[model samples]
Each structure stands twice: as structure tokens, then as C-alpha cells.
Target: MRVSRTFRLPAAAVGLSLTAVLTLTACGSDNATDTAAGPLTVVASTNVWGSVAQSVAGDKVEVTSIITEPSSDPHSFETTPSDAAKVSDASLVVYNGGGYDPFVEDVLSSNGGNSDQRTVNAFGLLESQSQVRDQGEANEHVWYDVGTVDATAQAIADELGELDPGNAATYQANADTFSGRLKQITAVTDGIAATQGGAPVAQTEPIAHYLLEESSVRDVTPEGFTSAVENGNDPAAADIAATRQLFTDKQVRALVYNVQTDDDVTRDVRATAEAAGIPVVEVNETLPEGLDYIQWQTNTAKALAAALQ
Candidate 1:
């Protein structure tokens, strides 16, 4: 099958009133026969994406996520040679584009994995990550947004369904359930948007920008967020001063930040936010274990809403 020349706009757009489910379950029959059922093999870029795929693929696909450890950060990730072999062997691979997981793109370009393998680039499918030019001390954590996650889930389900026709019904059903939760999360985010306005926010990277943007909370974030994220280091004193002053000056409504990586500067920023009574929406480097991707995301969304309001 020929790859699409460009990412297609997902069926659901921003600000829409709910959406249809497109979840795909892992490929297999319930009788412990999926191993014998010849499930579609998959490799996902992030653990969160892997969970989303599992929710949709239920028993239809075998998904192996590249990152599963809680300490893993996409910005700091370095793909190993063994990772390449796993990706190359898969019938399908799902990754978030827009420089989120550059390694995934590298594997696809050089390895020439499978000519017919379905490659789902969720960032490419939904929005133009091209014009999205902000990676500062603010992390580039886009998966926190419900819509983006939902779009990624739909893409996985659609492709898995195409690859395994026999279990399409199960996949669709699972996708439906996942989609419903996403919609509910969206509503929760909307409520957050309604309550909070003009919040001063700063972070170590642009990781939560998409979700921040979705919430419509004013980010009086310092310019350092963008600069520090680009350099992969802490911001300069002046930028930090400006960020801190937002609180001292009483110009900030909240502080949205990443608490995954240990950095004195980020910790300082959090200190400033706390001292100023500014709520800090701390986002993890990735989804934690035990909770599904949807639950993980909703957890962050709830934090954002609380901080903003």
C-alpha cells in the first residue's frame, strides 16, 4: 500500500461537540487463541500511545511501546539498535510527529521497515506541528490534550482494522469506549477553560503547550520557556527574573510546568509560583504505569483545570 503523501485532517476537529469512536483492540480471540490467531504486530513510539493502541486493538494487535519506564523523557530518549530491529519487524508503527519523537522518524526513513506496514503519525494526522514553534523550559508534551490523544487512538484503530479484517468488530467497539472517555475529558477541559482566564504560566519546556492552548489559560510564561527548551538547559537569570516577577508583580494567575526532570532552575520556578500562590500545573515526562493512557491524560487535565480555576 502506498503511504499517503501528507497527513490527513482527522474527522474530528477542535471545538467540535463530541466525536465518534475509532478505537481498535489487540488482535486475538478470547480463548487464549490470539497467539494462534496471528495478531497484527505493532511498535509504538511512546508508552501512552501504546496504551491507546492497546485500548483499541484489544485482541487484534500486539503492541510493543518503545518507552515504558516511568523515568523516560521523549526529549532525552536515545533509541538503541535493538529498538530499530523491533520497529523494522513490525507490521505497523505509531509515533507522534513534530519533533516529539525524532527517533521514530529516523527508523522509518533509514530502515525501510515494511513497505505495506501502516505508519501512523498522530501529530501529522491532526494538526500542523510545523507552525508550532515553542519549546522552552516548557516541555514539548502534546499528548496531554484530549483531542490529540483521541485522534491518535482513532488512527491506530483505523489502521489495525485495515490490517486485520476478521476482528474489526472488536477493535471498533474498544475504540468506541476509548473515544467516549476522550470526549468526557474534553468536556472537563472545557470547564477548566471557562473558569480560568489570564493565568501567568511558565515552564521548562513546551510539553504542555497544546493542552495549555486547549484550556485557553493565558500563559504569561517567560520567554525563557521557549529558549531553555530549545537549548535543553535552564534559562538565564534575566528570564528567570522576569518569570519570577510575574508572580511578585501579581501578573500571573498560575504556573504550568514540567516536574519530571530534576533541575534546580525548574524547581526554582515552581518555588516562585508557590510563593506567589500561583498554582503550578506539573506535567510528568510521560504517562506513569498502572493507569491507562486515557486515565493518565485525564489526571493531567484535571490538574490543569484546578490550577487554572
Candidate 2:
């Protein structure tokens, strides 16, 4: 797969509507399977959770991710009726809730079969475990939260075990193995935390809130700038100037750039950081092609650590 930058327009520019589902049949059996008679199936909101579900599922179940393309942002994902059908028919549905992938919730809410379908919501799991460490508002990107990702993997195993009792032990063992690897990934951040605690950085958005927080790096980006970027609105002139000052004044050690949501303003900020000799660590919301969850996250943590060093 080719690795290239994906510059996305504002979410509002891409209309978030279920018009295709309305025009097409609302309940077709495209890629939908019967778990009782045929192979068990798991549907995830995006490949990030899908990779976790697949790790726990092993070879016993078929996992499908609605947003498979690296360029597709789950926040603005447009679901179809066929995608709804897959969710309804799946033995288990894994998603990142907490308003991250509202389309998944919209599909489940509209489908009557959702009542019988099993689900593992990563954000919901984090809330239930009281693992949200943000001061006021929680970050919806729970996949970046290592602990939450571990919990989500185990939750998928539990759900799959209940659905396919014969493979319960296999599911549990796979989840354990997956969790072990996740620990290794966490250790990298822990190392960074111990050595680079309180080191200041800048972000184009709060995409890596959990990872950066875990590593104990301070985000010096103005709240107004990140908030505006996340909301798909341009920041005020003062907010923009404040953010640029972080780079020009050498207040930040690095810039955590989300490569998926690029725009002119963010591009300019990145350029400023580059010109100031601040290392920029690029991150993605979805899994890059040809790489699994562990590999992708390991790269992220290592990249952050290297940038800090």
C-alpha cells in the first residue's frame, strides 16, 4: 500500500447523511452471516477496533470494519443500509462510542435486531472502568488510550466467547496474548514519562491526548486552537497567533500532528514548527494499510519518544 498524506476537507464540506441507506434497501444480507449456522461475524466501526476484535477472535470469527480506508475519518463516516445489515446480523459489534462514531450508534438505534446483537463499546468500557483521566471532557479517541485498548480487546473476547461457546478458551487465550503485546507498547510511553515528564509539545489537534498524557508531555497548544480544529472551524486570529508563538518562541519540544485532518491553517502551523527546528510526529486516527494494531501503536509511541529525545 502506498503511504501518502491524506488532506481532508472540513467535515461540514462532506455532508454526513444516510441518504444512500434510504435510497437502497435498508436490510440486505450483503456480508451478513448467521452465527448459529454459519461462521460467527464481528462488525466494528473502524479498522482500529476491528484490529482489536480480530486479535481476540483469531481464526474462529470473521471481522469486518465499516471504515477500512486509511483516508476515511470515522467521525464523518457515512453508513449504508448494507452496513446496517451487517451490524444487525453480526454475532458481536465492536465500536468506539462516546460520540466518536455516531454513525455506528445511529445504525444500531435504527435496527431492531440490535437488541439481540452483542456489542463492545470501547469508550463506554473506559467510562465504566472510570479510566477517563481528562479533567472535564473525555477524549472520544479511546483507541489511543492504551489501557482502554487493552480493555476493549478483552471485552471483544468475552463477547465472542459468549457467542461461540466452543471457542471460548481460544478467545480468552488470544486476548491474553494480545494484552501482553499491548503492555510492551505501554512500556515505551512509560519510559518516556519517566525521562521526559513535563516536556512541552504542540498538537494540531488532541488526537493523541491519552498517549501524550501517558507519556507526561504537556500540550502547549492553545485550547482554542485545538477546539476549533476538532470542531472543523477556523480558529480566531488570536488563537492562531498564540499557537504559532509556541513554535517561534521555542516553547514546545515537538509537534504532534494528525496527518488525516490536514488543512491550510494546520499546514501553516506545521511549517512554522518545521522552520523552528521542532520535530513533528505525525499520527493517524485509523490503522495504516498492511499494519496491525500493535505495530501501528508501537510506531506511534516510539516516534513520540524519538521526537522528545
Candidate 3:
């Protein structure tokens, strides 16, 4: 996980000031009406959440995602004046909060955004979920956690329903459908847990923390190594040696590699895993081209299962 950059206002020539009038009125405001001329609009920080919003909103909403390219790191993503205007004019803004996408929070705080803008935060939802919350600090990668995504999907539906009362039923129905599909994905991870609970694994970064937790795999990745990588620093030589030992010794059943943030250190770790005949499963922060959220996660869960086998 890369650190989120501090957001700064774009130049005035970019037209941020013009978006002040586009602010979304608070939900249930007495004078409020559907603010969009066509379908309702949802601006999401990344395509992963954008895909979820679309599933619940169906055809009644137009969704725009800021980080659609897989190569773009969400943490270091720079917001444009156009992005601000999109959020300002949107009926709902969905983001992975919890420091995962600071740019979104920055855009919300600038003059163009409203404090009352209807927004769905995945990390915030995770904290509120008693079923999922634990004593440990929660992972900011909530999208990989099935429970959080399900809750977020429902939250999006409720917000959309409130914004467009006539389509409330449709929004809710879509959420139900989306949740049901999520359960199917959960079942796959549950099966992995039931069959191979506590299987040892290692990761290049902590990006798949929740996913591995759901599958009941014991992650043996060195905290020092992952922390250093996440903070955009190189791991200490001792930590690097220890991580390589895991691969050379074949202590872990598989290596979960984040293909997005490649570096010489990670590449060597991956190469070590391959030389030892340990399965290397590549993971990404965003959806792959031609795949939706469900398909992408489903593939990840199954790939882990296969690697373990």
C-alpha cells in the first residue's frame, strides 16, 4: 500500500470555482430534488468501487471512476479540477477511505465539495460492522473483504433510493442481487478455510490481507518488509534476507505478489519463489481489463486455491 499524497488545489484556470454551484444538497433536504438532468451520477475513487456502485444502481445511474487504469496507484493518485467537479456534481461519491485514497478526502474538503454530500466509505463501513471488526487495526483494503463490500453495496443502494424515491425498489432489489452474488464468492473462500485452514503464505505487500484472512491462511510475510514496501522504502537487508529464506526454504505454500508496484526487491522475491517451485499468485489492486469486481475477486480466490493445491 503506497502512502496517499497530500491533496493540493489545482490551478484556477482548471475551472474548480465553476463547480461551486454544482454541490449536491444534503440527503432529505426539504428543497432537494434529483439533481441530475439524466440518470443520477456516482463518482468513485477507483473502478473497483465504481463497479459495485453500478451493480446496485443498474441503468439508472451514470458512474465515473477516477482511477480506472491498473497502472495508476490509488494512494498516489492526483486529483484534477475535473475530478473535483465530478464529485461536486455527483449525487453520491464512493471511495475506499481509511487513508487508502487521500485524494478523495482532499477533493471533498476543497471549496467545490459539500460536507453533506452523500458518500459511501468502505473503510468506515468496516469499522461499524461488529461482525467483522476485531481488536487488531483494520486493514484499509476493505474491497478484498467480502463483508465490507456487501455492506458498502447496500449502503450505496439506500443512498440512491433516498436520492430517487421512485426507484427505491429497483435500487434495493439490485443490492440484494449483488449481495447474493457476493455470498457465492464468500463460499469459495470458506471452502478454502475449511479444507486448508492455517496454510502458510507470504505476500510482497499487505494488499491481500483481508482476502488471506477470509481464506484462513496464515500470512508469514515479514511485517518489517511489507511495512517498508508500503511506505515506499526499501526493506532492511536483514528483512530482505528473511523474506528470501521463506522462499528458498519453501516454508510457504504460495507467494501472493502484487504485480502493480514492482521493484528490484519484490522481483527477486518472486524469482526466488519460482526457483523453489512454490506457486506465485499475482494480485492487483484494481480490476483487470474485461473483468468486473466479482469476476476479478472470484479469480483471485480460485487462484489462491489452485496455488495451494
Candidate 4:
């Protein structure tokens, strides 16, 4: 028998039409099975979570991430039969829940073999750790928060241990080491808070909101503008004008642009910021190729710090 859990979508996810949610829920087949051998197989919705699992599991598990390209928008990712197959074969499946990757849930649900698998929903884990609440108010970019990521690493280690008890000690050690690196990443934010705290910044979306908050940077982007962009709607004319003025008037120290979800308005805003000589820092929702979770996040923090300077 397969076990299923109910996850409340974040408030922002309410925009996903009921039909779309139902469609996702109805995807995949119940005949899925774990076919891989030897080491445990892990499937992550995106490389951000995949990297964390890889770090904790080390050479003990083979991890596959569905969303790897930085140019891909995870929100619009379409699941395929291949992805379903990977989910089917995995001993562990990790995903960003809070509707960040509802398709993952759908795939697991339709595929019945997951009852014996270890599944880690980062959003749920963060909620259990008190790093966030299930009030549907939290941002889906939980990886941007160091504390949340640390907790997620520990959770992955624990789950991997349960699946492969022979290497439990090694997994715990790796997780502890990974947690220390996360602390170093947090230190970058601490340094920024000490020197550039309260610096006004702008964003095309809330993709990096958690990191900005940790760094003590004030996000001065118009909420309406960001909400419009995030929801795939045109920003209000007044909101656009107000945001453009923030750049032109040098009111914001930096413009943190989302590289994955560029649109005409966002492009215009970026060009406007550049024209006004405001530094623009590019951020992505997924981890880029070749860089692990710690490297990607640490580099992002360094870039933000440099831009603020």
C-alpha cells in the first residue's frame, strides 16, 4: 500500500487552476517499481535539493534531479514519462513541497511503489523544524534560507540512514560537515548585515527574498510588481512606473533579477537599472550545473555582497 500526505499549497500557488492541479494529480501510473541496484537511488525535483542529497549521501547514493538547467523555469516544468520512470526507480525522493513542485507529488501518487521509499518534502521538514510555518505564507524558495537548508541536509541524512543503515554514521558525519558549510554561508550574510544592513534592493521576483532577508537588505521592490510577475500577470502601470523610478532615482542599491523567469517588463526593468548605473545581480531558482548547493549559495551571497559594495 502506498502512503500519501496532504500538503497545503502556499497562498501564491492558489493561482494554479483547480483543473491544472487535478491534471497533475491524475498523472503517472501505479505500476512503477524500484529497478536500480546496489547504492540507493535518489530523485530530487530540482538540482538545488539534489545537491544537498548528494552532499549528505556522498558516494553512497546516485541522485538524479529533474530540473537542472538554470534557464528552465521550475514552475512551468512539464513532467515526462522519463521523469516518472526515474521517480519510480528511486529509493528516496526529495522535493520542495509548498506547491513549488506539485508534479513531484503527483508522480509519486500515481506511482504506487513509493510506500517503501524515503521521501523528504523540504517544505514540510522546514515547518516541522519551526524554520517556517504551514500557514501558506512562506516563499517556496526555502533553499535560500541557510537555516532551512541546514535542516534539510539533516533530514536527508536521516532518511538516507534509514534506507541504508550500514552507512548511517558516514551520512551523519557528512551532514554535520555540510551544516558547517551552511554556517559559513550564513556568515557571509552576517558580514553584510554588519556593514550594509538596511541597504535598499529591488527584485523582479521573490526568488532570493530569503537570502536578502538574511543579509539584512531591505527589498524595496513594489510588492504589486513582484506579485504580478510571479503570478504571470502584467504589473500595474503605476507599480511599474514606481519601480522604474526606484532605479532611475538611485533609490535602490542593487537590482536582484531572476534569470529564469525573464519577461518583457523584467527585461525593461533590468535595462533601466543598467541605464541608471545600478548594479544588477542575477539569481536563479535552480542550482546551476557543476556547482553543489553550498557553492551555488555561497557564490550568490558573495555576488550580492559585491553588488551592494
Candidate 5:
């Protein structure tokens, strides 16, 4: 989720700044002690990455997601003491960086440094792989990008192996299986693009911009409008007018709406799109319940492809 305001440290837990939180290292004790006796404990910033970790780790790891509540806006998520404890006890930590989940960083910092903990920052990994630069300029919803999500799954497997060498082979095998499923998702996206290439779409925000791009859909939403809404600010009057025009004029094939981050403006946009007979495909930042990462992406791709058709 896009963050407009900085998350404040709870009044009881004061004096922690964003810079201080970011500087906290993930490294913990080098003794190779498991956070727990039975399974490796993994903490993810949101259920999106948590689902990926769960798939890669299989039954060998216990995954906990900080943002599992569908109604919660991750941008305004406040950290709790229990969340900090979870980070402190986790053997592996996976988070979407790029300022999308600074609360994760803050939680890690408040729990103190963990030198032995294996960390995977999805945004940082993407940047290292040259997938994106300047998280602010790029879409923070990296999971929507099949290639990036695949890379993140591999990264999670690698970190799991490092944290638990005994399960290294299992991690590799699981990662390979997960990667295959991701490739299938890519093929599905390619198929859609082949049929609906250059189709114009409008979005309330850039939540699924990567997926839309992968499917070769042209997002005609004004950049100013999307940016403003994403940052929790009111869009410029001209941008709002242009966005409404895109719907009323039926210039787009579909409207990809962020179901998790709805507001008055977005509601009106959706109503207008529906009135124009444009299909509205709902997307979310968190993985839906009862579905893993692959399932969620596959289902969304199918819905989008159908809408375009």
C-alpha cells in the first residue's frame, strides 16, 4: 500500500524516527539457533508476501503476517507490542520496502537488532535485480509483477535455507515448484495480452499497475490523480475531471479498482464506470483469505482477462 503519512511511534514507545528504524540491521546471534524448536518462524509485512513465504517454505515454516485484516489500510497501520515481539522472535523477515511498510522497519527496530535473522526486502531485492529504481517513482505493489513475485519467492527460499540449513534441499525443491506455478501465471498473462493488447483501462490507484502492464493494458488514469489518491490526498480538480471523462466517454475497456482503499472520489468513479457499462475488476493489496499467492494472482488475471473480453 502507498503511504502518504509517516507512521508515528506509539506515545508509550517514543523517540524512534524513520531514519533510525531503517538503519536497524536484521542480523542477530550467529549461533544458528532457531527462533522456535519445531519450525522456522517467518514474519511478513503483509499477507501478500506472507502467502509467498508460506508457499516457498511449505510446512517447514510458520508464517505470520502483520496486515491480515482486509479492512485495514496498510498505510495507516499502527504497530503494536505484539507485532514487535513477533519480529524479535522471527528467524526470517520478509517485507515490501520502498516506504510502503515502514511500520515493519519500525517494529524491527523497536524489537532491537536481530543479527541472526535472515531478511528479504522485496523492494530492495527488486532494485538489486534492476527490476525497479526509486520506489517512490515505481509502483510499490511489486507482487503484481509476476517476475518480481517469482524472484521474491526464490529469495524467501534462499533465506529460509540460510536460516535452517537442515531444510535447505526442501526449500530449493519447494521454490522450484513455486517458480513453475509463477511461470504458468506469466503464460496466462501473456495469453491475455495477446488478445487484449493495447486495451485502455482506468484505475482508482496504481495498486495493480504492474499486473495491468504485464497484461499489456494501457492505464489511461492520469498520473496526478493516481498519485494523489495513493498518497491519501485529494486529486487535482482537472485530474478528477479527466478521470471521470475516461469513464463517461467509455475510453477504457475496464476499470481496475482498489477495493481496499475506497473513498468518495473512487466510489464516484466506480459508479460512473459502471454506468458506462465498463467492467470493474476489484484488486487488493492483501491476499484474500483461503488463497495462496499463486491462486490470488491467477484468479485476478482470469478476472481481468474476462473483463477485457
Candidate 6:
């Protein structure tokens, strides 16, 4: 059995010639050449990642997303025989690793992604943790973290270019545009820090904690926030009590909650923050039903603005 570490491919801005070399090319009438010259086929594990892939690959690659809705728990997501078909047929597969979307892992495990196949694990690219160091207080909602994603996008662009050298220029161009957007977001976060100031933020779960942290904002969630949310388990009563105290006692500036991943615990947390007159910034793991990845991220910036203010 081959175990492909999903976190491997990474970065942007290699040589322009390198990207140009990645462009699609006309090949001789050979079986391998025919396959190599065609449009790239990509499958992202979730819709959010699909949107990201779409932003870059555009018409150059055919992208399909299996998990389009946020309501579906990725942990319990069972792949259909068709998904296996998608896996076997795909040239590229993207997933948000770190055990957050183990379904992708399962798919890849069922059908290995080595050498000929390229797979991306967003979380695996980050600083590794033997035991999920950011657990309890910070759930691994990696898509929200700009730093990690910025790197992930670059990795995808480079690898896709490598996959079909004839389309390298297009891939690099897309990569550049996407990288600019990521940087633009960072600039926006900087503006938030400058205008809104680095306020103490509270969260029901680690929903978008990494993003908040990268924005220079501080999180003051009570312990057990991540573990409970990740497993769909209710937080301990003591933790719940402390979370309530955080609003009244610790004086949090705002609360960021996963609007889609709602449950009794998150609801209670939102209520506690609301009752305490704290503003809320709702976040979603999967892009909202109609909104694509970029628009959704733009909305996330707006939410940050509201909460920071």
C-alpha cells in the first residue's frame, strides 16, 4: 500500500519560462501523448476547494466537486461507487487535509495518488503536529487561513502546469492572479488591524481561528471548543461555563461562529455572545450554496470588518 502525504506540493512565482513550459502541447499520435495533451481533469474533495480550483484552472481544466454542501459532515461522508470512478479517472485531486476531510484520504487510500496522479492536501502543507496541536481551542478549518491557502494555490498551479507543460503559461497566469488575490486579502486583514485594531475575538469553535490569528486578532475561546465541534460532541459543562464567562469576564470584542455548522453548543455560544452585546461574525467551511469561493472569501472579509468594528 502506498501512503501519499497530502501536504506535499506547495508555492508560487517560479520562472515564467517554467510556467510557459507547462502549457498544453500538440503531441504525436501516441496513446500517452494523446492523454498528456488533453485538458486536465481535477476533482476537489469539497465545493470550497472546487471553487478555488475553478478560480485558477478555469476552462483549462475540468473541475468537479463531490461535496457541494456545507451541511454534509465530511467525517461521515461515504463515497459512492461513482466517486471512486471519479478518483480513478482524475489527473488531479485536491483535499483539505489534517484529518478534517478524511473522506478524501479514504478515496485516495482506496485508489492511490502517486507519481502519475497529483493530489493536494491543504492542511498537510502546514506545520505538522503529531497530535493536532491546535486542537481543543482551534479546529483545523484550513481553508480560512490565508497563509496556508496562498501556499496551497501556488502548489496547485505549479503542479497542474507540470502535469501538462503545454498549458504552463495559462496555469502560471492563473496562479499569479490567485496569488494576488490572496495577497490582496492579507492587505485587507492588515487594514482591519490598522483600522479595527487587533481586538480580542471569541469563537464557538475553531471555525476560522487560523484566519483570525493570521489577521493579528486574538481568540479567547474556552478549552474543548475544537474537539467538541470536530467530533459533533457537546462541550463539557465546565467548558461551556467558562465560555460564557469569557464574554462577561474576559471581555471579548467579538464572536466568530460557524453559521453552517450550528448545533446546540454553537447556538448557546452565539446566544451568550449576543446576550452580552457582542457582535457576531458568521463563517462557513463550504462556500454558501450559490456563492463561489472568491465571493465567499470576500464576504468573510466583510464579516471580519463588522466584527472588528
Candidate 3 lDDT, tens digit per residue, 207-298? 99999999999999899998778767889999999999998999999999988877888999999999999999999888788988899999
Per-residue accuracy of model 4 over 1-309 as CA lDDT, tens digit each: 111112233222323343343344334322123333445688999989999989998998888999887665556555666676677557788888877777777666655433665688888766776644432357777889787788888988888887777899999999999998887688899999999999999999888988998898999999999888887778999999999999999999999998877878999999999999999999988878778888888899999999999
Name the regions of candidate 2 deviating beyond 4 angstroms: 1-34, 131-136
lDDT of 1 by residue, 53-154 (tens): 889887656789998875665544556666765665567798877666766665555443234556877776555433464433323345765656676777
lDDT of 2 by residue, 1-309 (tens): 212221233122222334444223234432332464568889999999999988998888889998887677676675666676676667788999887777777666655433565788999877876744553467888899888899898888887777778889999999999999998788999999999999999998899998998898998899999888877778999999999999999999999998888888999999999999999999988899899999999999999999999
Give, for candidate 3, the lowest lDDT window spanning 10 residues: 5-14
Query: What lDDT does model 3 reach?
Result: 0.82
**lDDT winner, 1 or 4:** 4
Please provide TM-scores, in order, for all candidate models, with all chains considered together.
0.79, 0.89, 0.89, 0.86, 0.87, 0.81
> Candidate 3 vs candidate 5: which has greater TM-score?
3
Full-model lDDT for every candidate: 0.64, 0.81, 0.82, 0.79, 0.79, 0.68
Q: Model 5 segments beyond 4 Å from truth? A: 1-39, 131-137
- Alpha-carbon error at 130 in model 3, in Å? 4.6
Q: Please provide, for model 6 over 1-309, each residue's C-alpha lDDT reduced to its tens digit, 9 standing for 90 to 100.
A: 111122222222233332232221101111221354565688888888888888778788889998887566565565665664565457788888766667666555434223356787787766544265443443457888776677678778887887778887888888778878776667767777777666788876676776676677778676586456645667788888878887766478888887766777778778888888888888876778787666777778777877777
Query: In terms of TM-score, how similar is model 5 to the real structure?
Result: 0.87
Please identify which of the two predictions, 3 or 4, would achieve the higher lDDT against the true structure: 3
**Candidate 3, which segments miss by more than 4 Å at Cα?**
1-33, 36-38, 130-132
- The deviation in Å at residue 268 for candidate 1 is 1.2
Consecutive 10-residue window with the lowest summed lDDT within model 2: 1-10
Give candidate 1 regions above 4 Å deviation: 1-38, 128-140
TM-score of 3: 0.89
lDDT, candidate 5, at 203: 93
